[model samples]
Target: MTPVVELSGVHWGPKRQADILHDLTFSVAAGEVLAICGANGAGKSSLLRLLYRHQAPRKGTVRLMGRDLWLMKAPEAARIVAAVLQEQPTDFALTTRQIVALGRLPHRKGFGPGTLDNAVVEAALRRMDLTAFADRPFGTLSGGERQRVMVARALAQEPQVIVLDEPTNHLDIRHQLELLALLRGLGLTVITTLHDLTLAADFADRVLVLHQGRIIADAPPSQALTEATIARAFNVTARVDRSGPAPRFSFQLHG
Candidate 1:
């Protein structure tokens, strides 16, 4: 089967700047959950931007379901890929339900939402447990509530692939587990950047580690997140114990 998301020889950066991600080549299988882990400024978010088509790669190609991402129309891409990024809507005046309803905008047949669209929005609201806050202003939500709202919005898109940048940010431990579990059962391609190695290991089918501007390891959590790889990627001594249900990592400064 064709890969859900693929990048061959991809190098990316803003115009006139050095590429921040270099020579990336990989494919994400349909319904697979992949996690990206790296230290600060390891180009994790930069890589996600390319996958979501928020920014085109400076070189090479990005393909979605066997088609060039740049060649697809905006609506066509929107129907296939949804993203929840750190950046948010400038207009916080919109209420929670309204914000999530925006996801259905790409699916509407006419000027506004129809019955099915409204139903989908309602389902997404409930799935994210945002029903109680549906009438609240988006800006009034706490950081974690806002994050869940954004995920709900993405779920409302009903895309084949979902891209989340630092998805666990601001979420409490229970919510974090709930959210990752939910993603696991979604049956869509999931690509996310995660700060928590244990969460990534437990929730993802594979883990990709990035360094200054390139991928260093792309493998199962057990192999990709070894003590050696962690030390190299994060510049700290790491002790990874993988004997349990999930990999646990301990870090120490390199002397």
Candidate 2:
């Protein structure tokens, strides 16, 4: 099967010369959830930005299902890739439903939102369990509620590929698992950045460990979450145990 997203030697950053991602090459197949794991300043956000077309790569190329990302129009690209960024602002005074309905803007023709569009937004809110708070002001919601609303908005886009940056940031334990399970059930090409190693192992089909803007390890969670990799990438010692269906890590603080 053809991969949904592919990056070959892609390098991007603020300046034309300073490259954040150095010769990064990876591909995510359809219906697979790939987690990008790394410590702070590892360029995880930069990679996601490049994939979502927020910033173009200064070198190399990014292709979505064999089509060059740069060659695709903005709306066409937005139609395929939906993103829930880490830094979501709560300053927007719009209601939860209104904020989510904005996702349908790409498909909207005029200023007024249509019934069909509202239906999609409603469905998304239901999926995220935000129906009760749909009419509430988005800025008035709690952090976790706001996070769910953002996810609902992204789902409203109905994109083929979903890029999430710290999606579980403000979610509770139960909601975190539920959201991850929901994403997995969607069978969309998912690329997410997660700080929780255990959650990453449990949810992601594959894990990519980035260090200093380079991919240090790319493999299934069972194989990728080794003691050595964790210690090196995260600067924390850990013991890996596979007693359950998935490998679990117990952190060991270094002296």
Candidate 3:
């Protein structure tokens, strides 16, 4: 089967700065959930930007559905991939419903939103369990609530691929699990940065570990998240207990 997202020899950095990411190569199969794991400044978010077109690579190519991502027009790419980054419109006075309706912009023809667009937005709201908060002002919601609104907006785009950067950052434990569960059922190519090793193991089909902008491990969670890899990438001693149905990681500083 053809991969949905592919990156080859990709390198990126702010102009004149050393590359934030090195020659990275990987491919995510259709309907796979990929979790990017790394410490702070490990370039997880920069890698995601390549996938979603927030920034093009300084070298190599990022391909979506077998075509070069940069070759496509903005709206054309938006129709395939949706991104929920840390940036939020907290100052915007738009309601929750209005926030999600913005996802339809790539599909919208004229000015007014159409019946199909409204239906898509409504479905996205319902899917994210934001129906009750639909009419509420976006700025009034809590951090977790706002995060869900962003995900709802991404869903409203009806994207084939969804990229989220630190998606569980603001959620409480219960909501984090709930949102991850919801992602598993989306039937889309899901890529997200996750700090929680346990959650990353449980939520993703594969795990990609980055350190100093280089991919050290890219494989199934079972293989990608071993004791040595975790310790090497994170600079901490780690052990995995696999006696249970799932792999559990315990960490400690190297003495």
Candidate 4:
């Protein structure tokens, strides 16, 4: 079976001088949740940009649903992959519903909003618990609320794959669990970059650790997030305890 997403020998960099991602190869099966974990400047965000086609890899191919991502039209790709990145676009004057309704742009048949489109937006609002705030201006919302709104927009897109860059950013503990749980329940192919190793271990079926532009570890979290791997990737002394669903860690900064 064809992988839902695949990258082979992918190398990417904004300039010709330095590569942010080097020879990165991975495949995500349909309906699997894969979390990418790494410290800062490990090219986590760059890899996501490749997946979403925001930036093309300087070398190698990114395939989606067995087709070349670059070969697909913008609307065609938009229908298959929806993303929630860390930075949001300016929506000062737009309401929550309006911001989410933009997700339907790929599916729009005519100029104005349709009944079905409106319904999808409504459903997304409810799913993200923004129904009461649907009419409120997006700029007025709290950071967590805005993050949820971004997710609602992605949900509204109804894509086969969801890519999130730090999906837990700005969310409180309760909402973090709620959002991660919601992602798991969706049954869609998910690829997210998370700084919290514990959250990655707890929520993801598989974890891939990136370091200095390469994948250092790729396996089930229990195997991938070992004490050795943690120390090497993070440059910190740490212990990994496998007593629960996710491996717990105790850390000491290296001197």
Go through the candidates in order and give each one's C-alpha lDDT: 0.93, 0.90, 0.95, 0.93
**TM accuracy, model 2:** 0.96
The candidate with the higher lDDT, 2 or 3, is 3
Q: What is the lDDT of residue 231 in candidate 1?
A: 93
| TM-score of each model, paired residue for residue | 0.98, 0.96, 0.98, 0.98
Task: List model 2 lDDT by residue over 45-97, tens digit each.
Answer: 98899989888888899999899999999888988999999787555789998
Off by over 4 Å in 2: none
Q: What is the lDDT of residue 221 in candidate 4?
A: 86
Better of 2 and 3 by TM-score: 3
Summing lDDT over every window of 10 consecutive residues in candidate 2, give the lowest-scoring window: 11-20
Give the distance in Å from residue 55's predicted Cα in candidate 2 to where it truly belongs.
Answer: 0.6
- Candidate 3, residue 151: lDDT: 98
**Compared to the true structure, candidate 3 yields what TM-score?**
0.98
Q: Write the per-residue lDDT of candidate 4 for residues 131-217, one digit (tens) a residue.
A: 999999999999999999999999999999999999899999999999999999999999999999999989999999999999999
Q: Work out how many backbone clashes candidate 2 has.
A: 0
Candidate 2 residue pairs in clash (backbone atoms < 3 Å): none
Alpha-carbon deviation at 72 in model 4, angstroms? 0.8
